[model samples]
Target: MLKDFKPTLFILARFILIYLILLAIYQYFLNYYSGTGLDPYSKMITEQVRYIQNYLGYQTQLYNDIKNEQVYFYVRNDYPTRMVEGCNAISVMILFIAFVFAFYKGLKIFTFIIISLILLYILNLLRITGLNIIMTDYKEYGKIAHDFIFPSIIYGGVVILWLIWIKHFVLKDKVSNELKDKI
Candidate 1:
């Protein structure tokens, strides 16, 4: 019975350990940029969003709100969205990275983690851009779009990536071990 639960306990422990370590690092990062009113991550994300929106032919402007530590996104002179630390998606990336490392199989997993993080980052950029466009063009739907639709898209992307990693890495290793035991 003890043996039966050992693997489950180990996995849980690993997950929690990795999650806490990564979260601590993230908190430290936020603290380091707290009073400065200039978070590099948020700034980079805002710039990317601006580039993306401009490339899509939507004339946009960015205003740094130093007091609030946020960047507002203006579309055609209307402030429709703001980019903050949360909007930058580093938290989401941290969570994803924690999960991937918790189930670490080999060094090759690093490559997969990097690729997945890049995809997730791109997905988040698109989500923010789309949300800004929708909010600017459709004010009445802004609440639902921000509160429901955009969250679903970014989180759903994370779930899909997790499933892919589990299927290709974790479960594959487990199945191989089981086959070896049978042989």
Candidate 2:
């Protein structure tokens, strides 16, 4: 039964298990620190971003005067990368999940988690930067890019990366062996 089971599927299951465990840990910390379900890491990034905006001259002086609370301009959807409330956290979670899945399936340790994570992070940063450029250049199309195009880019890259890893690395030898054995 084990022999017949596709190695890629087995590895994917392993990845899911690892991902779930990490997600649980992150959730615990987030809740403990924030008094809410929001991810603490994301919150920190947002706060830092808000600070930067003030330095960039986007602070609202009226709000600062009236409420003594600095109000800064925030382009909520400008860069999908900064949408830590969902996109960033979810992508981070998925990276770990993909790593575990690939690792359990017999992928090389370096290729399994670290390389995959590095690839994802680079792409994620590009996505964020691209979104920012789009927002700056063409405000009208920013929403579509943020809501649809960028996500498709990230997810599509993930799918292709996993498929390639399984095809060329993990299952490559086993599939070849089966064919040779059959012959």
- The models' CA-based lDDT, in order, is 0.90, 0.58
RMSD of 1: 1.2
Candidate 1 residue spans exceeding 4 A from truth? none
Candidate 1: Cα lDDT at 101: 82
* Best model per lDDT: 1
On the 0 to 100 scale, the lDDT of residue 89 in model 2 is 37
Worst 10 residues of 2 by lDDT: 60-69
Compared with the true structure, the alpha-carbon lDDT of candidate 2 equals 0.58
Let me know the TM-score candidate 1 reaches against the reference structure. 0.95
Q: Please state the error at residue 72 of candidate 1 in Å.
A: 0.5
